[model samples]
Target: MSRKIREGLLMLISIVLLATGGTILYRQLLPSSAVKADGAKSGGQLSVRHAPEPKADVQGRFPAQSVERYAFSQEGKDLFSLLVARYQDSIGLPQSAVLFPKDAQEIASSPTGLRHDIWQSAADIIARKAPENALFLSWWDDGQRIHYLSGKEAWLRKPSDKTFVGPVWKALQDSLPVASDEERARLAQMARWLTMDSEKALSEIAAHFGASRPVYLLVNNDLLLHLAEFTAYGGTSLSLDSKNIPAGNDLHGDIALVKRWAFEAGDGNYLAQKEGNYYRVWSTPDAKAKNTLLVRLLPFIDSLKKLPKGVSLVYQSHWGGFLSVYKIDNQPIH
Candidate 1:
């Protein structure tokens, strides 16, 4: 097989899930209906399976060894660390990737999680832009990173009423008991808040914070191999489209390849971070999906030429996995 073809196939197979709490993430093979056999297999049928479960019950669920602290930066005291969960492989097995600083550069992008450097850099952005009293409304994970790295206050610790089980396991998930804390429940609504209509989402945010203090909306890159927590909690679905773009004799070929992927996905709203010659494209063909906050918030994937009204970009990291902070404008997106 050609190198390009081989890499595409591996990406198709290597896709995995998020390891937060009871989150079970796995990328299902794209349906055969859209298969393009020119140089592809598995019939081009890539669908996202979002299965987020129980909250991060560190003491109760995961073993001590499963969770470890990694000192990813020099900015912190001595060994300022972030708790990482290493649970399950591509097949829902118990095995996980127990990595060290040495592996940061190697496995630090999409299809994988952030590396030590990326974490520190993202934290640095928060430290610089975010004011001391600014309120952060993002996923719990980002909140923790913000609190740890920037020393800014974020509602990241109070275990949310087990991040709402994804669409696939709604019945079973609803059965799982949830804590009745209002703030926790509000936090749990992050899924709907993120994936819903932009206007309504903004309105909700306004209502929640009510100008009591400064609020910054934080989002990260969507080019992850695992089932993104945002899509899972929001029950959003999209096909996982993998491609092997030949970089030709230069970088121009690579750039063109990414552009083509964007065109195919109804604009640049559904792109995944490219991995060498391989690109994991998230295909959004529907109207509802086309208007989601997840797509618009992503830097390169946004369909707009520039950020629209009411949405201002505060910081965009060179690496998508790193966080992006946005300040809400009083006006609504037009």
Candidate 2:
């Protein structure tokens, strides 16, 4: 062979050897699952063995029955903590990923139960539309579910973070049967603050947390129904007398002393009269003489309709408008 051809052959041999060695090293560094084992001979053919099913780490873990029993126990703090931690680790998720299963289950099983599906729908919408770090502002009662399902931080994470309740109460007080436009304006201002969409409202909310961040507001039909409890009317327990007044009772004299207010309900106008046990509301003007509890709640209900200019209703559920999502347009205040 020529000397030049011999040298070229030697170089080609070196290149082949280097490539084989590099491939071997790469295989050795791969994960165990990536490495294949020698196959068994079956019917004159090599058959590769299927990967073994991974054995779950059952050690130091409670059985399914124990978990179920613990779920029903009164002192389940430890169990809940453990389950929440395990769920996070296993799913590679944050604490907000775990729905407040206990509360959701309880509500589902109640007589006046909320349909869990509705909550899931709302959560889905929030998760899709809300920014990653958005901080939700809502009644403290809804904090847990919002945090868990939406995977977002809530302003009212605990009962103690309910500083907004005072302002809400004041707004409710202003909403009472007073005949002053100034009182109504004050009530409107408080509503804006509670919704946290205006500059003043944002400043007040930021003061509580010591910083400002993106915020979203969630509302539902239950919120409308129980508006009084979230306002000044909620401060005192309501009681009713056993005496039933006639349907044609003089509302100005008999019912006006308690509370009387009108509000828009759906397409029609309605009046609420609250006196003693006779808390009744009706759309028909003929039923105006009857007393109702809804009378005191008209202001709060009306406030729900008056969102700030930049706040827009982005989502509404089909189920009796039970779920609503409002988005605040982030813009510089002129």
Candidate 3:
């Protein structure tokens, strides 16, 4: 080979060797964080925190009484117990179930066995109603502290509470006024959003709730009663004469009806729990479902302050009833 040709070949080999060494050095020296930081510094890439996988059953199953005991004051406990019994299984009842009697005085006179059965039935109903992706369970520690057995560390306090309160917390007090001003504001917005055209509502709901989860417009009125007429089924028999079971009647009735109508009748038009993206139009004269609905709505509606103007949120009612419409830009019930 000529000297010039040999020199050219040597230069080419040197370039290749240099390129290979630089590539290997870059891979070895650059940590993931360093790369991410450098990319961010360039204003082109983003860094995200990767959450760890959740552990199973971390808090385990807490007893209903434990939650009641921890979350409530003595008076609250008494009132809550009565409230639970009055509504029976909570979700599976006509609005009229609340009117069987008024006030805690009436519940105190009721039988213990009846109350126990109602409490158990209500827990079962809640478990059934809770979504697989969402947090489910009725009871908490007596101090109103919530601990879960799965995913991350077990004990969780409500995000809004500043104290980081936990460990033998008191049960939430009873006769707690429903719907704070902030809640009312959001609900008013929600109501107005519902008042929009059905097509609008449907589209908004599909977008916000995703295609998977069911939506609900819960209320305390005849509407839920009608829906509950459809949910009652599969509860343990209350007594030899089914009418005597005040404890399990509310939920059982729903299980029974759902079994009969939702499946047996095979009515596609009638909404049932079996379907995804269904609506729950819960209403009850006693207002347990209504109260529960309000409680659930609190944190969710708080998030609405961040929503863009004219962007309405819509929920689908599982049980067809009064809460179906959105209350748009209207006065909230004080």
Write one digit per residue (lDDT tens) for candidate 1, span 90-179. 234442222223233342222233444555666666677666678777766555445544556665433333443322122123222233
| Cα lDDT tens digits for candidate 3, 3-67 | 67765564343222222211010011112222121112322222211111222211222322111
Model 1: residues with Cα > 4 Å off, grouped in runs: 1-103, 106-114, 157-184, 223-249, 265-270, 301-304, 320-322, 330-334
Cα lDDT, all candidates: 0.45, 0.35, 0.24
Give the clashing pairs for model 2.
240-277, 273-292, 279-292, 279-293, 280-291, 280-292
> What TM-score, to 2 decimals, does candidate 3 have?
0.23
Backbone atom clashes (below 3 Å) for every candidate: 9, 6, 57
What's the lDDT for residue 260 in model 2?
A: 34
Best by lDDT: 1
Cα-based TM-score, every candidate:
0.57, 0.38, 0.23
- Write the residue-wise lDDT of candidate 2 on 272-309 in tens digits: 32322342333323222111212222222223334444
Q: Output the TM-score of candidate 1.
A: 0.57
